[model samples]
Target chain A: MGINSVTTMSPGVGAKLRRMHPLPIRIMHWVNAVAMFIMIGSGWKIYNDEVIFGWLHFPEFLTIGKWAQHGLQWHFLGMWIIFFNGLAYLTYGFATGRFRRMLLPIAWRDVVATIKDSLRLKLSHDDETKYNAVQKLLYIGVLLAGVMIVLSGMAIWKPVQFSELYFLFGDFQTARLIHFFCMAAIVGFVIVHIALAILVPKTLVAMVAGGPIVSDADQSGARHMNETGNHP
Target chain B: MSKPPSRSIFRPSGKIDSSILQADPKLLYEIDRRKVIRGAVSLGALSFLTGCNVSEVDQVQSALRAVSTWNDLAQSVIFRPNHLAPTYPESRVVKPPRFNAHYNIEDVQPVDVNGWKLELSGLIADKRPWRASDIYALPEQEMIIKHICIEGWDYIGQWSGVNLKTFLERIGADLSAKYVAFKCADDYTESLDMASALHPQTMLATKYAKELMADPFGFPLRLRTATKIGFKNAKWITALEVTNNRPQTYYEKEGFNWFSGM
Candidate 1:
């Protein structure tokens, strides 16, 4: 979708928007969504040291023995999925030059203006922009944190082969500490992202439907060209 | 023109297919409900089915077995060209190193050199016994190696002993034998796969860190498996059995992975 197509629509008249997200992007988004849930679930199972599947008739003390090993195998396999998905998304974004659209420094003036507008509770009515500077920065931070998590994970996984990396991280124990902290940070960001979606329902709708769920009353709030939506 | 159904009418547009919208709203709602119920039911069924055959503990036990299986699988796939752990320079040795397990090997009663008989049985045509000096007579291999414990910490030390494979070759193990189970003086016991047992680097150490091994360290006899984890290197060695069957180590019987190695 072209940038101009996003803004030229008229206001004050309800008109359905055509597709906003390209098909490939939508597919990647959904796959990533499903894969993430599985990774988190299996990951939890692996982390719970005392949790042993005891339903099968077995003596005590044996539960931790096998459950922990297999859980790691599954976790590593899921990791590869996340790695490939991130690689594809990054490659596509860079190739299309849309990477900058997701995160580019807005003028400092724009950031200050947006913050002021938000504090004034005018954010709901504020001319909807794709992503504010603060939002872009947050996204970039999350992306970089993911890379750090993967790198630290690798250092711990093969400390011998990645001896230099292991030494740099101050050995396996230290690397594990950093990896865990990064995971917590990522989870915290996810919680905030979901909260904002609820606060701004239109953004969530836009993501799923590839168009704003423009109400009849708000049609006037948008630009005039959006009335029929044909202009967009 | 008939206004498209108002946004208030619950019509979602764009990427959501129109056919989904065209379906009767009640049917759609019912389908969604059915989907939720079916999903829950399937999940419950899976849990129950798996539960019927395997308890939570059984899965854990399976995982323990998998650790050993994964080790074996790794060995089969990733052939180590060198099959050797790195040899550190003598200067790198940690002097007066803090030792953990088997540090006080002298505490145990010394095995009578003459009475001590190394039993070779299981997947073999005949059982044989070797005197203490007989094993000592073999070419002594001296090298520094790490004893990495599962709990986490590791210590580098010198090991002076003969290759267990050399002993295996001398005895002439039966073709069926695939593992060597070390029955030790203490309650502790361990088993090694044939490839690991036969690995040229594996040794039966009589000395630790270049000193005569204290009794607690299995003086005059101890299994030193360089390729395997520390647990497999049993102290106070008493008997060595060749076996086709998967030998039961005390830990392995308790669900620890048999092959605990890199």
Candidate 2:
């Protein structure tokens, strides 16, 4: 029933039970994923109705809504979900120090090394719990893009009520352009994220089922442990 | 000559004839082909993967509609009565503002400005009709504001008319009423919340760019509010009503947000 009893009975089972992705983090991740999918698909449909560029248009198959009006409805629905869900994710990340632990301390040397290894197809995924410099950078960039998309969306949605936001983005039309570019950034991030996850399938498994529970001490000594192949 | 009945593209009441499908197999095949393609790629596949049926799709639609209604309420709550939409300089105003209507431009039936009367009704102390001259004689206010369309395009225009609040006050409208509805000569209907109707920048615009409104535009009068989307500014004004009951507007019935405040 207790942790000590479980550890005494089966140490491997006990360690595996402690997850890399905590329950809240997993839930938030999946929820945010669904919300983002809805927002992007419906947004593309809305964009297609009155395209900013004369030539560019999202194909019908890639879009969500049946028509422009239906797209607007789906967009508003997704907007509320993303707004509240994103707020919750941010609060959870900051409150629990998850962001600090997982994404911080990205040195220039680490980034350069990671890029070099990545280009050579030699970047290690031995420690599922640790994020490389490139991953951290991408995550941080996407987070900022998420924030901008919401703000720019609000500016476009209620330009008069949020006149300050409208002015911040230059104007209604400019705000739309900002929102569109933010979406593009997010979409680009998603493509790379998915491609990397597929390349290292264990990372995807770690996110879904949580690969392993690495303690703070183990995480600190992960590199030394990987080199030594130590069980304990 | 008797005038033909006006057909609303928004509210299509007639059922499609099945005979047409039988008569043209090619057309039917085309329809089926598109449906199959859509099903293979879009939400249809999603619904199938999730084991969701038509009723579940309806449930999702209803849920989204509920959120939209809540959004309307939320927007009204956040709407500042005194916050003015940013005004542009004269140079920014788009000359001959882009024309938009449910129908094509050639089909526009220009209202007879000489015979046009602003009819009033519903919860107003004054239910009298006034000629176009009466509205033109009233004290006027001008605004150079952006006209944002629901479809994501926007343009700047100069509009001048009696402030809607001033007009409603003059007509003795019940200020506490829930909605101020409009009926256009073109048979397009629109409504505004009482708060939006009373907003300082809302007006029954009579002129554009210091000139009398062109026939292609609303010839005699049109609703012009800085806060709401362009479609909410119904053109070719014919009647105004203040009422507690919500009036369904043209696009609102077609699933556009009713309180499309921007």
Q: What lDDT, from 0 to 1, does candidate 2 have?
A: 0.86
| lDDT by residue (tens digit), candidate 1, B46-104 | 67765533445565345435545665565545434245655566665655443344335
TM-score of every model versus the real structure: 0.60, 0.83
Candidate 1 lDDT by residue in tens digits, A59-153: 42322213544545455545667778878877887785455644665578877887887788765534343577667767788888777877887
- lDDT of candidate 2 over A204-225, digit per residue (tens): 8878885566443233323222
Q: Which parts of model 1 have CA positions greater than 4 angstroms off?
A: A1-148, A151-155, A159-232, B1-44, B47-76, B79-83, B94-115, B123-127, B174-178, B198-200, B253-255
Candidate whose lDDT is highest: 2
lDDT tens digits by residue: candidate 2, B1-262: 9998898888569886678667979776667777778877877766665455645646566666677899899999999999998998999999898899989989999999888898999999988998988888999999999999988988999999999999999999999999999999989999999999999999999899999999878989999999999899999989999999876789987888889999
Model 2 residue B94 lDDT? 94
Error of 2 at A162 (Å): 1.1
What's the i-RMS for candidate 2 in angstroms? 0.8
Q: Provide DockQ values for all models, in the order shown.
A: 0.06, 0.69
Q: What are the lDDT scores of the predictions, listed in order?
A: 0.63, 0.86
